[model samples]
Target: MERWVGKVAIVTGASAGIGAAVVEALAKQGLIVAGFARRKERVEELAKKLQGAKGKLYAVKVDVSKEKEVIEGFNWVKKNLGPVHILINNAGIIRNNTLIDGNSQQWEEVLVTNVFGLCVVTREAIKSMKENNVDGHIIHINSRSGHRVPNIPNINVYPASKHAVTALAETLRHEITRNNLKIKITSISPGYTETEIIEAAGLPKNNYKDIPAIKAEDVAEGVLYALGTPPHVQVGEVTLFAVGDKS
Candidate 1:
């Protein structure tokens, strides 16, 4: 059975990397997928490709960091496609700078985009989910940096925000449990994967052999796996490291 058939899903950062992979995977599973990104060109191209292939997909231009845009994006999905049954808070940014050398703007950008953006999207999406009394699933693409910062003292802000995300995910899980909203939430901690973000970070391009980088599709598979489980069954957390990227 198609796990996402008839379900509507929202994937942020869908223009590239794991975000794109997740959108593509969900669409292939028969979900009505909405792809959101700040720059619409790539997402639009992906949507056109999906449409041409007779797949269910929609592309929306949004900067997830903006509250109004986040609200409008999810509302658009609800009104046009359907209530969002799934949300992948996959939009994030990385800043490779040390405490003293780091740009203040970069710090703000990292926190606002990775943390605040997540909150806005989740809040609006949950409003719709709760109003409809639907038990939906939210998957956050967090990083291992959340758990243990790399030895490299640079990239401080990136890890700090990710750590916040890790804590936020756990706190949300607890809150939802106590309130009995029945919504399922989980976070996946992924080590270095071959993506544009890494390349932008000045990492090598897609060389997994040395460090064991996982593919974006690998993360997408995890999302689908989580979505497939029965509501009563929840995978609280999943941590994936490329086989050789050892912890």
Candidate 2:
């Protein structure tokens, strides 16, 4: 955390949920954070609440699925906040459907946002780091489902996208090692977290009330933990779950 003070970080899907939590936590830790989201006003609202924090938050209007938008956002960061020292790939979506019979449009939407969008963001952020010679960290906000397919309902292609994330983290590490880049990759997989993604996907708020769940702040703490490690110690993966979470 001391090393990252005054440095810059970018967090996608930052308007709310885990993304918002991470933005607040990072800014409090003294890192200039850019919160990218389609609903820019929400980030701005959060920014107002952190008026006197150690660092600042800039809201960038971006829809991650669009490569052009993502690239532009990175450009803004480079021109203003300097090279990215940290990238949090937290923008993702899940649909309220099933594989046996699901809406094609919904499936495509999920894939484009959760999988392809993540790839584009990672690519641009890494490019920024390499060009500027910054030893950065990339944290993927993956789910426990990424490692194991959950038997929950209406998850549709979510688990598949997350599984892709699991592979991507490892693949990125190998690429970094082969290329001699100092970038570190870590996958923070949380189980049954209390977030709006599930409710937005048609899962009623009551469905998981009795079941175990963790708060978005808990995951944000885990992210800080991974980032606070010594430069030579790369925390490859961190899995967080409530005591009774079955997922």
Candidate 3:
């Protein structure tokens, strides 16, 4: 397989967790990476970690959920790294609450970050890519909850947001096809993963263990595999569930 020797890629939420892992994976393959996140210090540390890798990594701070910031971040990447050849809309926030307990804040935060952020980033990327006439590839990191019930109560907003990702990815693929653009878009849905997101949710580390929950690296590997395919071949959708997950 041909490696991303001179390709430019952008990963949102690269400050940590799955986004960080995705940055590292692409960097090892020699893709110039623009790591976008709101956390300056952590994103800088991630860039430093990738410094020893084959590819060059640049960190930018932006709140992806905000349209202005998203536009600015992508513009910065274009100015500094050239047009993006690949994009991973990996920035996401998860909030758990039942209908009764879930206030508007919890619902709004998850929806805005997961859904609106993805849209904002992708819109900017498509605009830049079209301007540059670059045939780009997009990978969306969705979740298993988007497909089936996890048998857990509450967490309605998180699942709802992920479901929207799944739907949006599929719809975007067709739009690309209709436009006759040489672009590929795919979505990878992961089951419970061991990441800071889960930790922040107050779940025990690796607690989704009826089947061993996947690691951030596992999802990252999935993205790498999708991107590594031949340009003519597109891996449309991948749903990765835990080993023992009935859903």
By TM-score, the best candidate is 2
Pairs clashing within candidate 1: none
Candidate 3, residues 1-247, lDDT tens digits: the string is 2546778898999988999999888888888988898886887887777788888888888888889888888879878889888999999986656677667987888899999999989888888888889888999988887786576655667887888998999899888989998888999999877788866665444335465677899999899889889889999888776677664
Cα lDDT tens digits for candidate 1, 149-233: 7755357688889999999998999888898898889898888777889656653343334566788988988888888898788
What are the runs in model 3 whose C-alpha is more than 4 Å off?
1-3, 203-211
Ranking by TM-score: 2, 3, 1
Candidate 2 lDDT tens digits, 121-199: 9999999999999999999999998999877777879999999999999999999999999999999999988888987
For model 1, the local distance difference test gives: 0.84
Q: Against the true structure, whose lDDT is highest?
A: 2
Instruction: Compute the lDDT of residue 220 as modeled in candidate 3.
Output: 91
For every model shown, the clashing-pair count is 0, 0, 0
Q: What is the C-alpha lDDT of each candidate?
A: 0.84, 0.94, 0.84
Model 1, C-alpha of 233: deviation from truth (Å): 0.7
- Models sorted by lDDT, best on top: 2, 3, 1
